[model samples]
Target: MNLKFYTFAKNIVKIVLSPAFRVKTIGKENFPKDGGVLICANHIENLDPPIVGITCPRDIHFMAKEEIFHLPVLKDILPRVNAFPVKRGMSDREALRTGLSLLKEGKVLGLFPEGTRSKSGELGEGLAGAGFFALRTEAKIVPCAIIGPYKLFRPLKVIYGNPIDFTEYRAKKISADEATKIIMDEIRALLSAGK
Candidate 1:
């Protein structure tokens, strides 16, 4: 990942967003200082990624939708900012491989397990992709919740929960769907507490 660009972009985002919205973060101590980590959050608005990225203590490598990468300026800027394209609505093996590779390199990956943004701002069902990654690698899974509406000047909070260890589940050889449920349940709890 481009550390310099990521830092620059993160700083810019903080400056731009801090005044426009009432942003707050909790449970920052839960974030691991080193090693591969998976940050699974609820997809609310398009700005969710940046909000999470700025609040996070570590740099995040986000898996954005493939369509956004084809856009005019974002196409060139996305990768430089540590954002990668992921083909949604299907099993894109290449994208999966890229995510796996990043985890193997001890990078932090930001994923919205619901696949797409919730129009009504409610959390959606978690997909198997995140579970697949968590099961395949020894990455610490951190359940995050981006709470509150996107309205200007509204109080928006991003809460990071404790890291989830899947060693027993992995040893038990649980299905991806089952693992996803466990992850989603933790996210649901965080969202509830945030509210």
Candidate 2:
């Protein structure tokens, strides 16, 4: 998406959603202003990505679900806001390449480690693909906690934790699941913070 369009779209959506949802955000400074960074969070609802994106003053190249792309209006609107589709279950090399490309260009990539929305609003185990990105790239990984089911006119919170340092994990012989677990644990901690 072009910078001009993104800025306009972002501002318009923020204006509408912020007040309507009463979205509360903490740890906005957790996001690095310069260079590439990965924003990893638990999936609460389809709106989680936009909530996180607008809350943090950064342009996020979100790895969105493929099903949403099938939606007529959203399919077009989401990409305009820097969102790309990802086939959830199996590996989608195209999505991975797009994420890598965005990272290489020193852009922020937003993704959900859980790979799908949590129906019960509970945290669950993460998929290894999120770990794979963190382990392979030098980009910082920010664990974000999204609380609430994002009902209209309801309270929704997006709490961001400090970036997880994975330099050691990248150097070690850690399995994908182990690496995923390591990342997910931080997100879990963020969810439990100040509780």
lDDT string for model 1 (1-195, tens) is: 578888998999999886677899999999999999999999999899999999999989999999999999999989998889989889999899999999999999999999998988888899999899999999999999999788899999999999999999999999999999899999999999989
Tens-digit lDDT track for model 2 on 1-195?
367888898888899999989989989887788888988898977778778878977888988888989898987787788889888778999999998888878899988888888988888889988888887678888989988856889888888888888898888968778888988899889888824
What's the TM for model 2?
0.93
> Candidate 1: where are CA atoms >4 Å away?
none
lDDT winner: 1
For every candidate structure, what is the RMSD over all alpha carbons to the true structure, in angstroms?
1.0, 1.5
User: What is the Cα-based TM-score of model 1?
Assistant: 0.98
* Candidate 1 weakest ten by summed lDDT: 1-10
Per-residue error for 187 in candidate 2, Å, reads 0.8
For model 2, state the Cα shift of residue 6 in Å. Answer: 1.4
